[model samples]
Target chain A: MQLDVSHISIQYQDNVVVDDVSFQLAPASLAAIVGPNGAGKSSLLKGILGIHPLKKGNVYFNGQTLSSVRPHIAYVPQRESVDWDFPATVLDVVLMGRYPHLNWWKRYRSIDFNIARKSLEQVNLIDLADRQIAQLSGGQQQRVFLARALAQEASIYFMDEPFAGVDAATEKNIVSVLKELQAGGKSIMVVHHDLQTIRSYFSSILLLNKKVIAFGPTDEVFTPERIQQTYQRESLLL
Target chain B: MVESLWADANARTVIVCTLLLNSAAALIGCFTYLQKKSLTGDAVSHSILPGIAIAFLFSGVKDLWVILPGAFLTGGLSLLSIEYILRHSKLKQDTAIALVLSVFFAVGVVLLSYIQHHGNGNQSGLDSFLLGKAAALLSADIPLYFSVAFVVVFSVLLFYRPFMLISFDRSFALSIGIAAHRWQQVMVVLSVLAIVIGIQAVGVVLMSAMLITPAVAARYWSHRLPVVLLLAVLFNMIASVMGIIISYKYPSMPTGPWIVVCISSIAVLSFFIGNAKGILRRSSLTVQK
Candidate 1:
């Protein structure tokens, strides 16, 4: 349940994007990674998850390296990263969550289908299981990704901007799901926008601008002065 | 007319060869289309010309076996060069594909002209590769076609799930430890194989049409991967039969172009009338609203 990222750096053509970042997540904590545009918020998450190459760093979960604990980790990337017109149904996408558990040449069993169905139901998308993904609205598309992540049944989840461009109902559904996951003792980290909802939605906050600015409980770390330092702006909306 | 055409051995060879080649091309073409790299087939087909000329010069013969290996080498090199340019430079993918395609094709054209001027009488048929000569296929070439097609079809079936996963969401596949790079390489290899085998029947110019047209047509009809793939194969096979029959009747018509024409016709028809996302369906729905 323990997740630690130590001394992570990522570079794109000699310009460091994520510079020597480090952080730790408490068990069952829901954390938000808050940063401005070009703050390397996405890069840090991608680097730790091995999607992007790390210039230098190590990621461990419960004293095990990322590769060893890969099956227990689930990642829901940004909605814009994939083509929605790809030919697949909602259930077909959710079933992709079970791929890590199956070896090559092993077909999905009945249990995998059941889990996928349940995941779709959890997102209230069971009726749309057979629907083509291209027919979904933006919020429904985001929920499909969430359901896919939930189907993984992972101990830890990393989501990149689940609320970006989503409707209010989807935003509420996602927050409730995050709370439910926390209640079930699963650690979650989201690369979040919308500075207004940080305190209410997340238990811990990691203020990031390429490197870790602050990491602690929401109440202690979410101060106005710290937010100003993290964003490097002199505004007052909080 | 049908009985008489099927009764001829040469006609039978042409029919079987086109069926196998187009089926294999269309099968793998579904994935390439989904990956948004359909032009990779075009690049590979055009780039392999230099290899064919080089093999002809070295072997001093136009044997299918010798020329195919050479075509494969250059085809693979072109794909690697495209990958290299994309990785090292900031050039976009289309630019890289265009750059590699024209450069390699120029070299091939130069080598081909060199052989035409200096090489002996055996080099006369080499120019046929520009548009293809399905009528020139000997029975001995049938086995080679079958084996290549078998490998392509079998490999696709074996790695169907991984291919679908990577084509759909590469980052998600990598997150799940699916070796996305390795599967990408596998796709590269499959595309090369399909292009190399098809160039002789469909020619360098029209080979990409064989690879992409049926898949595009199939997409208009289905919203499922398996169904799309099946429909692509079926459409390709139907077009192949029609092409063979038309060429058989006319005798002056080239088999390769006719096959391309038939498949393209199907694709254009699908654009207007297909069931899933055709112009007719969308327009009708709009009118209903």
Candidate 2:
């Protein structure tokens, strides 16, 4: 599957966040969005994901408009977001991933349960399946969210800051999961901030700073000047 | 003659109306509880009194048809205002929630007092709604409340998954094809319906507690959504039945305070003696550790 983003521009309350950025990705490719705090890395990703409406642009997932590619997409929201103290167990949270596929009046069936269990095992969270969400550690919370995303079983995954605030061990586990998904012919677009790991982790990079600063293979875009330009544009993301 | 008064048609009508309102309260309570929009319930309930007063000016004979829309419109507007304040301001959600709540409630109180002192005739059955009198419910009120409850619950059942998704993460839900605004409107509509259905049997001041208590109590027993809803419905039914029975024993006693006392008692019980997520259980386990 090949995805193309063309002339995508986005603004929030009259201020432009992403300025005419564009890029392309092929099947099984791993791409990282790199940018300064306010450079619109997250905004650009959200735009592609269709959460943030574009000021002007279009995204094509396998030659189809992204707005029309709803069923094939999965999303992992930021960890800093959401209240973990919500009264739900790990299994309950994971089961929510199956919601898009099910009818509104229908509860989760045996098939949904099986899929959720498998996803939990994949994330090594089968042991904590019955645990309340608040009881999980930061790393464990990330893994739980991973299990939920995995349960969605979409061909394309959009993750926002998956590695943020995680311990080294959880980071390795998550990377391994991402690699496994990539090997299975699923594409992933991750909004990432750590400059040191960009080269090693991603095959493609879209460096941003309220604009498409650069877009190419990681080795080409992860240069010192691009990194400086992305972050130096602003101090805070919000 | 005294025993015959107990079996009168008016008493039967009151009982039926109370049942319908309680059921509606439980249904809306489930959604508000899950979305953590329970506090918004309080804000809307308190804000609708002035709207009810305005609605009464046009309504020659005070009835559900007149007051229900007034309550719904005012309650829905209250939520919109709160949301607007939160979205447009630097104030955090909790702070904005508090501000909107107090301002709207204060306005409602002023309007209600004005109507109470100046209005002519005993037709001002309005003051009784301030602290619901189940005894005042008439035969005409039944179908209106039951229909509203049915609609609210049916809508909830019909859009359960989509609303659930949007409630969890609006950004991600938007990305995945769920229209955030549409689902939000559904929630607001359902919440307004719940509040309106409640105003007759449970006073607007205490209606939010009616919507939130069962869900809060249910959380102690269940770790899943469906289970939580079922448990909440069960607890709400029990509280309603207990309050009705208490009010039955004391003829002059208002049902609103009794119901609130029942809900509060249940909440207290859940806080202490709850089986799984209760304070007593957590404390005992901690001591063991």
Candidate 3:
């Protein structure tokens, strides 16, 4: 599926948070959205997914609006975005991924549970399927969210800061999952902060500063000049 | 005394009515607690007072059916006004709640005082709504309580999944095509309905306690939503029965305040001795480690 975003702008009251940003991604690619704080990286991602109302823009997945392809789109929000103390087992959270497939009259089927369990296995949390979400460590909680997205079986994935507060081992696990998704012909977009691992982890980069500063393949767009321009800094070492 | 209490028709009616009201309150309280809008109940309960007074002044009678609609309208309006203030001003949610609560409640007090001074003799027992007179609940009021409880319980069963999803993660629920805003409205309406039905039995002042105390106690016992809801209902029902017995044995005691007292005592006990998250259990685990 082709992901297209055109002329998206988001404003909060008087402040223009994201301005006329446009980008497109080919199918089966791992892309990172990198920017300085307050650059609207997260806001842009949410606007495209229709989670945040855009001041002006349109997002298309495979030549269709988001509502038409919502079932095939998955989102992994920031780990800090949810109340971790909620009363839910790990498996229960993962099963929520299958909710889109079921209607009001339908309950979770055997296949849904199987898929949820398999997703948990993929993230190495199968052992803690019945454990409460509040008991999980920071890395485990991030993995729980990743496992939920996997259970969604979506063709395209949008993740916001999945690697923010995790250990190195968990980071390695997430990168492998991203590569696995790409290998399976799925598109993955992430809000990433680390500049050092950008080349190794992503095939493309969208350098942003309230606008599209540069967006292209990592080899071409991940230049020091573009990084400096995006962050508006001087004499930075990478 | 227990056997005679069961044998009396009025006592039976009060017991059944309190049970239904408390059960419904406990069920919806779990969602409010999860949404972190526990105080919404308090605000709505207090805000409904003016509505009741207005309904009585216009209708010239204190019929539960006539006053309930007015109560619901104002209760719903109170929530909307809170939302409006939050959207339009720089005030925070707690401030909005407190503002709406006090203003509406004051209007209600003024209206009630006016009716007492100038209105006809039909407004005699209207002040019972302030502190609640559960024993005064006639058998005629049973059908209304039954219908409201039916609506509350049935709506919960029907929208269980969507309600849980929205309470836990609203954005994710919307992403999955859950119509999160509509479900949120449903939650708000249900909360208003629950408060409206409960104000007569529990009174506006103590109604929020009926909603929140059981839910808070239940949270310490389980780490799953279904279990938490069940435990809350159980705790509420137990307290209701205990309160009824105590009030029955002492004829002068009011049922609503005693019910609140019983639930609060249970909550304190649960705080210390509940299964997993209680203080005693955690301390013991640390000692073992």
Candidate 4:
């Protein structure tokens, strides 16, 4: 499946935050959207997921609009945006990802539970399935969200700041999981702020600063000139 | 006093009705408390006062069928106005709630006083609604309480998943194409129904306590919502029974205040001694450290 976000703009009240940005990603690729603070990186990700109404333009997933293929797409919201003290177990949280697929009145069957457990196993948190969400460490919480997106069984996953505050070990684990997903033919787009890891972690990069500064293969678009332009900091490369 | 209370046959009906009413209040209260909208209950309860007064003034009777719809509409309107203020104005939710609550309640008080001074003989007992007189609960009112209780319990059970989803993470729920706004409106409407049913027994002033205290007590006992709701209902039933007995024994005591007192005691106990996350256990752990 191909993911295309073309000429999308976003505004909050009178202020236009994300101006006319466009990008595309082929299946089985790991891509990053990066820029400095207030660069609209998160806004662009939300726009593509249809979280907020786009001021202009559209997002196409495999030749259809996002609403038509919503089940085939998944979103992992920022860790900070959720309530940590929410009264739910790890398994309960992961099971929610399957709600879209099941009938509204249907209870979770053995199949759904098994899939949820398998997703937990992939994140190495199967033993903590019954634990309360607040009992987990920060990294473990991020893994729980990853497990939820995995249980979604979506072909395209859009993650917002999945690695913002995680430890180094969790970061490595997430990178490996992304690699595995790509190997399995899933397209992954992440809103990442870490400039140091872009070269090593992603094949494609979208440099954004209220607009699309550059977007293409990492080798071509991750140039210092582009980073400088996006961040408005000439010394960023040094 | 206790023996006389036990001997009265009508005591059974009063106890049962109050029990059902408290259970319904506590069940829906769990979500409102969890959502940090505890004050919403207070606001809605106070705002329903004018609705009840208007319903009585217009209909010249205090029938449940007449008074309840009027109260539900005004309560729902108060909720909507609070929301509107939150969205379109600079005032915070708390300020909006406080303003609407006091203003609407004032209007209700004026109407109630006017009806008492000038209206028909049917308006004589309307003051019982101010603090609630469960001892006055009639056999005719029992069926209404039962039906409302059934609706509250049934709706909570049937829409449990969607309600939980929307309450926990609204944006995630919206992402999945769940009509969160619509579901929220349904929950609000249900909340209005709960408030209307409870006001006849718990009254307006103390009703918010009935909606929040049991849920708070239950939260101390469990980290899961289903457990919390179950525990809340159990607590509610126990408190309601105790309140009915106490108020029956002391003829001057109002049932609503007694129930509030009993439930507050239970909440205090749970806060200190509950097994899951109690202050005693927390302090003990700190002492060991």
Candidate 5:
């Protein structure tokens, strides 16, 4: 699938958070959106997904408006945004991924449950299916969310800060999952903050600072000068 | 003693009414508790008093159909005011809740008094709405309670998945095209109806207690939404039955207060002795560690 974000601008109360940002990604690509604090990276992703209202712009998936192909797009929100103590099991959260496919009054079929189980196995959390969500570790929680996105069976995945507070093992697991998803021909865009791991983990980088500063392959765009320009500082990149 | 209470026709009617009322309340209460809107329950219930009083002032009778719509109007207005104050003013949600609660309750008190002094003798039972008189509930009122209970439970079942999704993660629910705003509006109407339905048996002063206590007690025992909902309804029925028995045996006691007292005691017990999440369990687990 081809994902295109055209001239997207997001504003809040007269303040422009993301301004005229545009990018495109082909299938089987892992792109990292790297930015400094307050760079509106998360807002830009949400705007593209139509979760956050866009001041102006259009998001096209496979050359059609995103709404026209809603089921093909999946989102993994920031872990901090979720209520940890919510009364749901791991399977319950993953099963919610199938809600869009089910009819209003329809209950989940055996096929849906099988898919959820497979997604959990992909994330290596099949053993914890019945555990309460709050009982999971931070990394486990992130994996659970990843499993939910996997169960969505989407071609394009948008993840917001999936590695915010995860441990090293969880991070490694997530990267491996991303590689597997890429191998399966899915396009994944992640809002990443870690500067140290960007080159090794992502095939493409969209360096942003409230705008599209640089967007291309990692080797071509992840230069020291562009990093300095994006963060608006010299010492941090040093 | 239990058999005697069950054998009396009037006592049986009160028991049946309370059982239905509490079950409806507990069903709606689970979602409000999950959303952390228990205080909103209290605010809306208190706000309904003036609506009931005004309805009586206009209709010159305390008819169930007439008063319920009036209560919904005032309850809805109170919720709107709370939202408006939270948005436009610097006050926090709790402060907004408190401000709306006291003002509306005061207005309700004034209206109740005005009716008592000025209105015709039909207004005699208006004061009973403050602290409900379960004894005064006639056998004819059973079907009304039954229908209210049916609607509350049926709507909850009909919208279970959407309601659960929205209450836990609203933005995610909205992202998936779940029509969160409509579900939220439906929730408010259902909650208001729960309060209105209980007014005769568990008056305005104590209605919110019924809405929160059962759910709070249930939370200590379960970590799944469905289980919590079922437990809440079960606890609510138990409390209502116990309250009915107590109030009947002691002819001077009111049903609403006893119902609240029973549920609060249940909540207190659950807080201390509940499985998994209870205080005792935590303390013991730490000691074992």
Candidate 6:
């Protein structure tokens, strides 16, 4: 399902964090949102997911308001932001992704477990499924979250800073799983930080700085000039 | 010797009530434990005595029926004030907690002093409300304890996901349309209700300890929410019973203080022995790993 964003703005108190921004995503598009720290990248993702109250605008998923699309989208929050040291097994954390799917008093069936296992396998974490979250390495924790999202089986996936601090193997695994999901016709929106990866990893971009500075194909919009400006680098050309 | 000679039926009654009250305290402790707001119980418990005194002055009955509700009202209001101070004001949560706790408890102390100095028509029972007199527990109190516990357990069962979601990851919960305010209100209101029901047995002085210590001890055993609640309840029941029994054996003892001491001991032990997060447990895991 396609997403249409109208002229939405967000302000925390009087500080205008997200200025009027609008965009549309075709079905099954892979969009990467990137910017420097304190650029309101997370806030924009939150706005689209209907988390924060928009200062002004509407977000429609599949021609319906995002609120109306319950249980159809999944979010994989950043690893650093979560308390992974919380006493829960990897499998237990993954099962939480199924909460929206179950009715009251209904537990996960064998099929649900199978889906979780498959997701874990996709992230190559099936063997460590029963291991406690605290015991995992940095990259393993990221994939654990991905495994949880895969268990959701949602149409649109919104991930915030999914690759901040991870080893090369874990990133490759995530990219490969994401590619598999795209092949299966699902849209993925990612909040990213690294500039070098935009060309190879993502299809589109949402360059942000409390506003949509640029949006379009990764190749067209991720010019060195845009990267330099977003990163606030010292200009060199005379 | 005279008091010891006279103590018989009243002693046994106190023992039973102590067990029951501690169990209830621990049950509520589980919720506060998961939220990591354990000290809140102590703050609320100390602050409720002045509320009780105020409620009595207004209603002129000093009955639990009226005073209990009033104490909860004051405590609940205190929580709202704390949250407001936290959100809009520049104060940190710990600072706000310290502010509310000291201010309300000091008010209680002043009100209590007035009652004592003026000889306000037999404030004997009121003293027990401060330090707690486990022997003073009546048959009438059991049902109240049971009812509050039942409601707490039932609410947790019904809204388990919402509460867990909010407690686990608030941003994720909000993203999913969980409106955390509604359920959080329910938790805080229930915590107030638990504090009200607890004041009689644990006493306004040590009631907060009962709410926190059980959860601390339980964390040694499990992480799953249901298991955490169960372990907390078990630890509290044990401490409450032992506290009452010891106080019985040694007269001139306050049951609330003893119960808190016992629960705190358990907390210390749990910290050392906890399997997942305990220092010893982690050490053991590391050695084995």
Q: Write the per-residue lDDT of candidate 5 for residues B4-106, one digit (tens) a residue.
A: 9888877877787788788889999999988999999999999999999999999998878788889989989999999999988889999999999999999
The model with the greater lDDT, 3 or 4, is 3
Compared with the true structure, the alpha-carbon lDDT of candidate 4 equals: 0.85
Q: Which parts of model 2 are misplaced by more than 4 Å?
A: A107-109, A234-238, B1-13, B84-124, B283-289
How would the docking of model 2 be graded? medium
Judged by TM-score relative to the true structure, which candidate is superior, 1 or 2?
1
Label model 4 with its docking quality class: acceptable
| Residue A178 shift from truth in candidate 4, angstroms | 1.2
**Candidate 1 on A57-78: residue-level lDDT in tens?**
8988998988998999999999
TM-score of 4: 0.94
- TM-score-best of 5 and 6: 5
Candidate 6's C-alpha runs over 4 A off are A232-238, B1-20, B120-122, B286-289
* lDDT per residue as tens, model 5, A1-238: 7988889899987799999998889888999999888899888877887777899888888899877888888889899887878889899999988887897679999999999999999888899898888788889999989998888899989899999999898899899999998999999999998999998899999999899999999999999989988988535656
What share of the reference contacts is kept in model 2? 0.65
Put down candidate 3 lDDT per residue, B1-289, tens digits, no spaces: 7688889988888888888888888998999998999888899999999999999999998788888988998888899999999999999999999999999999999999999998799988787677677776657777998899879978887889999999988778877778888988888888788888887777888888888999899998988999998989899899888878887787667667888998999899989999968898866442100
Full ranking by TM-score: 3, 1, 5, 4, 6, 2
What is the per-residue lDDT of model 2 for residues B1-289, given as tens digits with 9 covering 90 to 100?
Answer: 4244347777666665666667667766877877788888888888887678778766745688888888777787888888898778888878877887788777777877877777766446787677677776656867787788888777776786776666666776787677888888878888778877777667888888888998888878766666776777777767766666666678677677788898888888998878767887865432100
lDDT of 5 at A8: 89
What is the C-alpha RMSD, rounded to one decimal, of candidate 6?
A: 3.2
Write out the backbone clash pairs for model 6. Answer: B41-B208
Q: What clash count does candidate 4 reach?
A: 0
DockQ of the candidate models in sequence: 0.53, 0.50, 0.52, 0.44, 0.45, 0.44
lDDT of 1: 0.89
Ranking by lDDT: 1, 3, 5, 4, 2, 6
Q: How close is each model in CA RMSD to the real structure?
A: 2.3, 3.3, 2.3, 2.8, 2.4, 3.2
Q: Give a tens-digit lDDT track for model 1, residues B6-58.
A: 89988887778878888889989999999999888899999999999999999
